[model samples]
Target: VLVASFAHFCSFDRCNSASSSSVLLNALPRPADPAPGHLQCPTCVTVFGSCPQNSDIVTCPNGTSHCYNGHIAIRGGGISSSMNIQGCVAKPSSFLLNHTQNIGVFTVMENRNQGDERGEDWNNPIIQAGAAPVSAPFLAWVVGLGLSLALWGGAPSLPVLYWSGPCPHWTS
Candidate 1:
């Protein structure tokens, strides 16, 4: 009889503690969600055509953080068409930008700015399809050196090397 009474008390105590903990959990507050950002970008969709004269600028929905611009041309299986698109995107496309190629039935190109290309935008001074841009720092240093030399009435003593091809009249 003593054991039975002790077991009943222990069970009651356990249940009471569990309920108290549950109440504490319920009373604790949770961290609130972050507010969404307001980012606007151009939005357009064209099929076998170009973007309209005045494409719409739209507020990107939450989680979309890029402005996408791409072109895709399909020509196979009796299908010949192209699609141009510009819009707010969650991620940028992986197509090569500012270049053209023939790949199976799909010729894809992308010319989007993904917010990271701020100072190094590809179109500022214009560049060829497959050429690395000259470093601005190097150019600045060269210009500074030239100006300093000009101000000092100095010329480079090193010979100007100009051998475009094997010297035209020389035979090896």
Candidate 2:
């Protein structure tokens, strides 16, 4: 009976520690900006920053720019600037729950059991497909290879073939 009780206490302690750790990790002080500057953004939490390549960015469809602290900036159809983050906790003045009524809720279920009944799980499908994952190095390699092949290796490399009417030399 004592052993069972100790085991139960240990499990409870583990659970509590796990919950506290998650809360701490999620609520850790966000990184601070290197310098102070006028920040323009819709929300504090929506800061932009460097993300791994292939990370998705959902943006405004129209032409206006959305600037946020710690978020990378999209300019002229591409990413132009890195995000400078200044960590600060924001407090709402009042408890306003009605504003979220319009938002929809979705439920996610986690399967904790390690069972063979589950199908194959793919964390990253693109890797399995043999496609490039869009890292900076991979992108550079692709671009360099494409440029070299387009300019040197193929038929386009021969200037004579461009005119192609059987006259060889240039005239004045």
Write candidate 2's Cα lDDT for 105-132 as tens digits.
2111111112111211211212334543
Candidates' C-alpha lDDT: 0.33, 0.19
TM-score of each: 0.35, 0.15
Q: Which candidate achieves the best lDDT against the true structure?
A: 1
TM-score of 1: 0.35
lDDT of 1 by residue, 1-172 (tens): 0000001123332232221122322333433322333444444446557765355444444565455555545443344555555544445443322354443333434444344233213122223357453222110000000111111122221101111111211111
Model 2 segments beyond 4 Å from truth? 1-16, 21-30, 44-172
Model 1 is weakest, by summed lDDT over 10 consecutive residues, at: 138-147
Cα RMSD of all models vs. native, in order, equals 33.1, 29.2
**Clash numbers, per candidate:** 0, 9
Model 1 CA lDDT for position 77:
31
